[model samples]
Each structure stands twice: as C-alpha cells, then as structure tokens.
Target: MREHYRDFLIRNWEKGDRTRAAAVISYVLSEYGLGWEPNDADRDVLQVEEFYLATGGEFWVIEHQSQIVGTGAYYPINRGEKAVEIRKMYLLPSVRGIGLGKYLLQQLEAAIANRGFQQIWIETASILVEAVKLYESHGYQPETGVETARCDRVYVKYLD
Candidate 1:
C-alpha cells in the first residue's frame, strides 16, 4: 500500500530502490558524524534483500518531489522472544521534527506485531540525539550491552 506524508510517499522496497535508499542512509549517517561503514551491523544496508525482506522483515522508502529523503526498516533478530531490530530509520535534516520518524516507527511496530513478533529492539549511537529521544518517548526503555559497533545504546519494547 502507498502511504503519504505531506507530499512524501511511503512505500515498500523495490529493486530500483536499493541505491536511493542506501544513499539516504549513508547521507544521514555521515551527517551525524557516524559515516556509514560496511561493518557487521550495517551490512544490512548493502544487502537489503537478504537482510530484511528475504528474511521476512520489511523495509520502506519515503520520497518527496521524486527525491528519496528517508528510509526505515527492520528485520527479525535473535535478541528476545520473537524479536526484531529496528534499523535504517533515518530522515533528511529537512524532514526532522515533522513527525515522519514517529510515523515510520509506529508503522514498523504495527507491522511487526501483525507478523507475530513479540518485541522490538534498536541499536543506536548517542550522537543520534533525535533517534534516542524518539525511541525513549515511544516506550523503548533503555537497555545495556549494545552490540552494534557504531552504536553505544540499546532499547527494547514489548508488543505484548
């Protein structure tokens, strides 16, 4: 289904979306001083098919004026009971504070729950202040032992 956000369209991943989505993710990471790297946790960005969709998870891309501006995605993880990890939830600075992040997150949670996932987890770096705040405000209580190399914080929320 197609979802809209103030002229932006939210849609599922397509083969053609790989490059645009990766650029969005890389841009956002570099903008935050995180500089996208081809590491363990981030390998998913380069392998969206195998990492998310092919694994039974979902990925979304948001475009405005025909330009990709943001991305959000998740994949099943082995952390908790039937758990999934939120990943690549990034938006251009121009789109921040406009509720897109919250909207994407709510959509992800709903989709995950509908798929029978029991919990959601996220790994993020403290440098991403907006992301950290968004997760906390959405009932994702902070957790310890973050395993993502570029991340120092972990948060988890139960769907049940």
Candidate 2:
C-alpha cells in the first residue's frame, strides 16, 4: 500500500473521539437502512465508550485517510460461560469493498483471543444480509434462533 493508503490505524477510543465514532455509526445505520436519527447515533457512541471504560471492554476505531471509517467493540457477556460479545461492528458506506471490514474483524479476533475470551458472539438484524454474510464469512454460525431487540438474528463463533 502507498503511504496514503496505508494510513489506516486501529486504536482505543477516547472520550474526544465520540464525534468520529458517531460518524461511523451513522454510516452503518444509513447503509443498513436502520433509520437512526443523529441523536441515536450520538447516544450509541457514548454507550460504546461507557461500555469499554466501565467493564474493561475493548472499543476500537479504524482511522483511514485521517477519518474514522470503521469501529467494533467486545464486552463480556457471560463470564461463567467464558464468552464475550462482539458489538457495533461498522464500516463506512464509502469504504465497504476495500477490505477494511476484514481488517477490523481480524483485529477484533486478535484482541478477543489475547484477552482469553473463549467464545465470541454477535447479534445483528436479520434484514442485514450483508452483515450476516460478513459474520458467516468469519466462521460465525447461527447459535440462537429468535428475533430480539426489534427482530435481530443472533450468531456465535467459538475460538480455538
């Protein structure tokens, strides 16, 4: 990759990064036709930050070309079950086919593995065909079969 194309970096999200994070969420909401309002995206950004800061979850932002284009976080879902949930994986609309999503997924997998999380779970809308495909492409399989939180399909991945 050229120097400019090599500008992508994933780092811990800071409080000051809310605006950038919101931008990525908005892109996701829009691309998936989620109809999320600006306030909703902003609120989610705060929630993500709080999740990471409070429970020691990992929140990451992908900065490409000096802009936040992708994001994902992992948080404990069931300590007794030795599992963690991967949440809010998003890539901007414009950067969809450029391999950024794969990079983000790889980073999340590495982070979760390093943290000793035995299982990784993800819940995404059933209508989100692309997201579902992404998860399935990454070795995630359907673990749960009910619609929840406004009709979403939940999936799980086990790490070796």
Candidate 3:
C-alpha cells in the first residue's frame, strides 16, 4: 500500500510502543548488515523513558497505519552536561528520502535546545553513507574520538 507523509504521526514513546520500536530498530539495523547485540544501549530503550525524561530528553516514534516506521531519541551524555547524545534514529527504507529523517532531526534539535542543551552528538557507522551525509548536510561537523564497535563516525552540532 502507498503512504503519504501526512499518514505518519510522530509521538512520544508509550509503554505499548516498546515492541514495535524494537522491531523497527532491529529491522533497520539488520538491513545494514549489522546485528543487534543484546547489550546495546538501544536494547534498553524499552525502559528508558525515565532516563530520558529525568534528563530533560525524550524518545519518539513515527507511526503509519498504527505501525512504527521510524524512531529516535536523545538524552544527556552525563549528569550536568550541556550536551546530549542522539540515539536510535532510524527509518524504514519505504519512508526514506521523503523528508521523514529531516523532520525527526529538526524535532529532536528543537526539543534539546528548548531543554537547554548546547550541543547534540551523534555516532554512526561509515557504512551508512546516507545517514552521515544527512547529518553533515544539516550542519553537523565531524569529530574525532567517540567511536564505538559499530559506529565509527562521530558528529557534533552546536546550537545557538
């Protein structure tokens, strides 16, 4: 079936969204030839509402026809830090190139800025060229360090 941008609704992650969120994330990761490790921080997203809310951050999902097609979140990198890390930002292929990723990034940036964050950080794999390009195109600058086993590219965006 065909879907339009307006058919998707972005909303806060509720208890019921855990399963679908995980599924969507897993699917996207797998599509990139990446396996979802049980210990990954994203696996804990199912229970991270308190962490996000307590840290003046939030997690959101894009739903279409009651199914989650995309997901993203941001949380303080550490206590008292003015920086937050963007996490779990992924969208199904069916919804890519239609402005959904940009929409989510814009929304996340606004939320983080409104919450007093001064910068946003993101870690991504070089294999995902499109994602890296998207971040760079949106003003995120490449940075050294902050590499993970799976994510080697680190980017930072300072908000004015």
TM-score of each: 0.95, 0.83, 0.90
The local lDDT score (0 to 100) that residue 37 gets in candidate 2 is 57
Instruction: Give the per-residue lDDT of model 3 (tens digit) for 84-141.
Output: 9898899999999988898788888988888889889998998888899899999999
* lDDT scores in order: 0.88, 0.73, 0.83
Error of 3 at 13 (Å): 0.1
Best candidate, TM-score = 1
TM-score of 2: 0.83
Task: In candidate 3, list every pair of residues with a backbone clash.
Answer: none
When 2 and 3 are scored with TM-score, the better candidate is 3
Model 1 ranges with Cα > 4 A deviation: none
Clashes of each: 0, 0, 0
Instruction: Report the lDDT of model 2 for residue 77.
Output: 74
Q: Evaluate model 3: give its lDDT.
A: 0.83
TM-score of 1: 0.95
Off by over 4 Å in 3: 1-5, 79-81
lDDT of 2 by residue, 70-130 (tens): 7888888763267887777887777777777777787788888888888888878877777
